[model samples]
Target chain A: GAGVSQSPSNKVTEKGKDVELRCDPISGHTALYWYRQSLGQGLEFLIYFQGNSAPDKSGLPSDRFSAERTGGSVSTLTIQRTQQEDSAVYLCASSPESNGFPNRGETQYFGPGTRLLVL
Target chain B: GESVGLHLPTLSVQEGDNSIINCAYSNSASDYFIWYKQESGKGPQFIIDIRSNMDKRQGQRVTVLLNKTVKHLSLQIAATQPGDSAVYFCAERGGLDMRFGAGTRLTVKP
Candidate 1:
């Protein structure tokens, strides 16, 4: 019943500081994804976690961006040495597919998102 | 490399009229497509989705049409309402990679 949720609805941090954004996926959702939305832009894929498998980090824009899912539930996206370009809405989504096979057509439930502003 | 794009950046339709948003994806291998509606200051909300096997799928008042032959997708809203005003995005998925199109802003004029 509870949809995906993120913490720290708004975060403002100085450039070069590290910030961590948290996401709580829906119950029974084993697939989680992170995306970034710039002002008036489309969603940019960041990372994805599926069950216990190694996370997909190909979408990470740079080495400064990293994410981890703990115990297959909550995920944290950490940005090291944040830049002004990193300022955007960080959105997390989850789906009910665990094996990744059924994920092809599964609908992803999104959270309210955490707005990160890098000064 | 995969990229999804929208033909129009904005669309304005009168209340009670129909609205259609178009998207084109470069990845022909994409097997799934989804439409999402995002209001200001909110995360995207799933509107509807269609698999590659199906050419069309209908929801309450929304319909998603996929033309795999041309790698094109469209979302049609019947009897557009003021509440339907928002940014609509189309996403294409192939395997574990998903790409989202630049959103189309829909403004319903009363």
Candidate 2:
């Protein structure tokens, strides 16, 4: 079975340009999460989707950040008017359980991540 | 809000020795704590986890201790090996959010 994966392992763009990062969760995973890892913040959860329900976007830093998951399998995080501060690694994770998760707990398997650099 | 801290803290330990990495969390409502390991240029991989209700939980070679009172978490690795060398992070999860602490870099010397 394949684990989580992210496309465009490395990306570079101008500061004002927009960028999108994609994530493919494990098969049958009902819960998907997006996060940003930076030198100042470590790793911060950006948003998460449970099945077709609304995503939890509380962790998103600002209005410039947004994400959408389609068909409950793929997710894309888009940043509008990227800035140098937005240069960081974007990570994706998924689990079988949405709310309760499990007693033993369903570990959120992570992807290798896509490193974004805004010049 | 996200935490502001170091990119990585270095931890050097001799082989067969035990290593403990500590973390301080800001959110007090958090009930679940987890430890993750990240190799060079790799994403974080789950190592162990401990809930707030339990003060300590042990695995084959690792242990996670949570102190809800002070909002702190720690990961202890027994018989640290060269393979254990990596950056370790402690995360607090609750209310659909998981906040990761600044990672600690562990170097196991044979």
Q: Point to the candidate with the largest DockQ.
A: 2
Q: DockQ of candidate 2?
A: 0.50
**Candidate 1 positional error at A103, Å:** 1.8
Model 1 per-residue lDDT tens digits across residues A1-119: 78999998999999999999999999888888899988777888888888745457778999999888888899899999999999999999998874646363368999999999999
Leading candidate by TM-score:
1
Runs in model 1 deviating more than 4 A are A98-105, B1-8
Whole-model lDDT, candidate 2?
0.83
Worst 10 residues of 1 chain B by lDDT: B1-10
Mark the regions of model 2 whose C-alpha exceeds 4 Å error after superposition. A98-106, B1-3, B26-28
Instruction: List interface RMSDs for the candidates, in order.
Output: 4.0, 3.3
DockQ of 1: 0.48
TM-score of model 2 (CA atoms): 0.87
Q: Report the Cα lDDT for candidate 1.
A: 0.88
Give TM-scores of chain A for all candidates.
0.93, 0.89
Q: Clashing residue pairs, candidate 2? A: none
